[model samples]
Target: MGGTSSELRDLTNRLYERAEAYGMEVKTGKSKIMVSSTTNTSADITMNGEKLEELTKY
Candidate 1:
């Protein structure tokens, strides 16, 4: 989890809502989200245990 916990928290909330609507639940403990940065460094962004792709020089 990186790139501010607030951002990740928001995303997680949205995902949870969507899943509930579809009779599915997002088990953070069981589910895995990965974040990565696409750039020369290719840094990985992990937020709230979720991984997302981050573009450099954006």
Candidate 2:
């Protein structure tokens, strides 16, 4: 699915929330954002208020 950066961030936040509820944690450094679109827009997703690094290819 495709969405704006804000939507992506929200999704990430929700994921973190669910993970927390289950006593799990997100490995932010191991996480990445893959942009399939060629829009040149930056993927500024954050988990626990910290920005996640974006990868050109995973």
Candidate 3:
């Protein structure tokens, strides 16, 4: 999903909501967001009231 930050955040939020409905949850502490581009593409993608960390490189 390589799109604008807002798009990604929206997709993430929808995903989290669907997962929650199925009795599943994303462990935010072990979750991360990675952008393929070199430029910054960060957005407030929160799950379970916690913002996910961004992975700079990996």
Candidate 4:
């Protein structure tokens, strides 16, 4: 079995909370987050990492 879109959304919300606690700004795009500062942003919490993991994991 694999995770669904709703699961990915849930994980994203969790990550967003974490990011906000760290003073990072999160902007939602079509299916991704537009980070405020390019240099300080990490690709891990963005759509690719979290979303992909959520979709692939059982």
Better of 1 and 4 by lDDT: 1
Q: Residue-wise lDDT of candidate 3 within 1-58, one digit each (tens)?
A: 6487788888888888899999998788998888666665455667768989876542
Could you tell me which 10 consecutive residues in candidate 4 have the lowest summed lDDT?
49-58
The residue pairs in collision within model 4 are none
lDDT values for all models: 0.56, 0.77, 0.77, 0.47
lDDT of 1 by residue, 1-58 (tens): 4474466557666777788899986655565544444434444434345665454452
Q: Against the true structure, whose TM-score is highest?
A: 2
| Poorly placed runs, candidate 3 (over 4 Å) | none
| C-alpha TM-score for every candidate | 0.43, 0.80, 0.76, 0.43
Candidate 2 lDDT over residue span 1-58, tens digit each:
3377777877888889999999998899888887666656677677776788886532
User: Model 4, range 1-58, lDDT digits (tens) per residue?
Assistant: 1144455456787877898899986554444533334244323344424333211111
How does candidate 3 score on lDDT? 0.77
CA shift of 29, model 3, Å: 0.7
- Sort all candidates by lDDT, best to worst: 3, 2, 1, 4
The stretch of ten residues in a row with the least summed lDDT in candidate 1 is 39-48
Candidate 1: pairs in clash = 1-46, 1-47, 2-46, 33-51, 34-51, 34-52, 35-51, 35-52, 36-52
lDDT of 2: 0.77
Alpha carbon lDDT of residue 40, candidate 3? 59
What CA RMSD would candidate 1 show? 6.8
**Using TM-score as the measure, what is the rank order of every candidate, best first?**
2, 3, 1, 4
